[model samples]
Target: RVIEITLTSPMPDFLRLLAQPEMGIFLDGSGAGPMVRSDESDGQPLLLTPLPPEARGFPAREQWQSRARQVAVSAMPANSAVDAFAAGEVDLVLNGRLSNLPLADTGPLTRGTIRLDAALGVFGLVVRSDDGFLAEPLNRQALSLAVDRSNLLQPFNVGGWQSTSWIVPRELANGAAAQGERWPNLSFEQRRDIARQRVAAWERAEGEELVLRIGLPDGPGSDTLFTQLAGNFTQVGITAVRAGLREGAELELHDRLARFYSPRWFLNQFHCRLELGLCSEEADDLVEQSIVESDAQLKAQFLATAHNQLIDSEIFIPLGAPVRWSLVRGNITGFEENRWGLHPLFPLSQPPT
Candidate 1:
């Protein structure tokens, strides 16, 4: 009566041994929250069980149980986990990147098993605000216009993926308001021309070629994206070099934005005091206001203002909404897509009668 399942990385792999295949449940250790070993409140179906020393695999293993089911968890790498799911070795795939799965409409595997969740993350580029060449907002805006986001994301072909201009995805609280943009109707060619002009001005002021290194994390779509970005920057007369992540890389790719919820979490990333990556004093003030204001409407208004200020400043170029996809066996039930991109395991992992 084991219910077997596979989950995304950082969860643990040996989980299959503790719980029977049909009785398996997977919990995201990174996001277990209140469900992490709590024996309070409503009688949640799952039971938190301690794994024996041998069951600890390499270091440790955590398990959960219910009358009908038992779950073991382990960290499985993204590619291997997706491969396992496709091979029918696992009943479910939780939190796999869209770019890593075989999701083309015509692919045999994607007939109806792929699920999309509206995740709360931003995939974008970040430039250090203190860099002399990047300090000007116009230079940043030029970089944003150089790459057409829709074209860049077209290869992924994810259904729920949306091109975003602001760091905060629109579905988040009060994030629906348009955060503003530098140019509205300019064609790619027009935008390129403008970017070239801005770069020329920057070069004349600094007396050096406008060269910048862009660091990107290694992943399925990252290499292609880097090549695409380099081409776009070339068209705009800026020398964009694709590099691995380093401290002084002028521009860098951030595929996963703020992982947790809350508008404050999203806005605080760019504040000067935090020193996360980019920094903005004006945006920092707005974030502080949003944090302290007691009134709900005022809080929303303050966030909207902060978002607009950041967007206007062009510190980040939001590439597209973060990609979150899963592959489930046809018979799996009780699955629901939510904006937060969380799927509680207890209800779904109940053993069949």
Candidate 2:
């Protein structure tokens, strides 16, 4: 008999590819499955579907129950799904966010958890080139130096999470240096100072107010973090507008916005772009070379150059990295951790005995 599984995300192109005949897995969500009339049923072979994008607004627990036969809600916020898993109403609970393991083991009901990726996502600042004040590399660098990354992470309880070196996380690279080791000597304060001096130099070249528009996501902690960053900007006499989710897309679309935007910004978990409307002829050439370069060393050099240019230009301000965690049941086999914090669930050849 085929082992059926359910997934909990809006069906993307990749997931659809995984559900093909050659893939040999049956995947669906509660929305596509037959309506269940009862709370409990004898264990049966069925493919439950994952969560839909529209369902993200629903409570996490409700979302979980809508997908798996058993809900193993891990470090995600406590919700009805977690309560159901704790009460032994579900078969398996998978934690989506950073795991919040209980101090006391709940026996067989509780499963083991692991950190899948050291850095899951990133947050940073972007400037608008059209603003005219950030036309020079020194101007951009000054903005970068003004940010206190350590202080930014303090409220989030992630003080140790340092700034990233590459456009993507180190783990994602095939043979590149880890982001942590690239610049060990530069302290947070030093980086800020560098940015200040750069900005001052730019002012000498062309006198203009270094006004900036900062776009942030509309979720929890976004507003608070940006507010803190604004204080840091003020210290350097840079005028900053704390734009929230409302202004993000418009900022991205504005062609002149690249002056302030980092090409290597993380839009979401799956989407990361190196250029956000800022066009540098040299940077674009290097990006193209990096993508096609077959030699490992050459590719690394190209990527490094691009990274440095962006930094030197102060195109974007490096913020703290985001953390993501996944939890698995003890009986579940073949669930290896990945750099992306994702696990392969398709090759489910066996069920927990």
Candidate 3:
């Protein structure tokens, strides 16, 4: 009924994390490893929900299996899933953002069916391109300062959404966070004025007009955020334009959930080799040191130093917490709220108590 794991290094929070929901040891009786698939349904009409693509390899326990016999699984885009859930076609829809937010005036979405998870991870724009005005670190920092992060999620109309300028969420940093906010004392407008000055300096020195090509998704949230960013850039004496994710945009949002709640995990996401674009080698060195350092305080120091180094380099323009949401029918059971943003399919299929 239990399993034991021995770590070569100290992982103080390992036991705490293991005790959380959807966390456990499993016996891969199939021996497929990462190639594993969903639970087998014995020819039942009800559909079983799906785990995230990365989680397909996890074995399905009997308790997590659907109460309905031999159910199926459906995968589709968020919008289509919303439409399907609104009708009686699908039993459950997961990971739909508020951009396709069906009108609250009607439908199951208006009821208590909407579920939002406060996922902890990097949800912000990274400097994807090294060319253009972004070539300079100060210019990148200017862009970070110019954007009104507080308003980026206005399109969703959701509350309690945490907007932050730091890569690691402060509360989750343990003792690793050094300073709280990047600009705690400065007002949003004050931050913009400083950014405008920096941008003006770049324009005057280079004699080249500033342009920021931001890569974004094709959705209402992206539109609102881009428009606000463009306006902010304009006020800061730079022009902002939207670019496709692959269209050589200098900046793009990287919304992701942390596999493990560690500052190192958050810091590794932006490493140069990770393909996250323009990162500090010095910061990478610190992260590497933290990996081998046996001293706990020394490790925390390294992480804190790396975090502040990234902030100073303006490698990523922090937005807010990554959004993970789903519309579950009122009758649905076994869907529990968790920070990891993972909802097992079998649990959603369990009949309502």
lDDT of each: 0.67, 0.48, 0.73
By lDDT, the candidates rank as 3, 1, 2
Give candidate 2 misplaced runs (Cα > 4 Å).
Answer: 1-116, 120-122, 165-210, 246-275, 290-296, 325-337, 344-353
Can you tell me which runs of candidate 3 are displaced by over 4 Å? 1-6, 13-70, 98-108, 174-179
TM-score of every model? 0.72, 0.53, 0.81
Query: Candidate 3 at 280: error in angstroms?
Result: 1.8
Per-residue alpha-carbon lDDT of candidate 1 for residues 190-258, written as tens digits (9 for 90 to 100): 988988999988889889998888887656566767777888898878887777776568887776634
Q: For this target, which candidate reaches the highest lDDT against the unseen true structure?
A: 3
Regions more than 4 Å wrong, model 1? 1-67, 98-108, 170-182, 204-207, 257-262
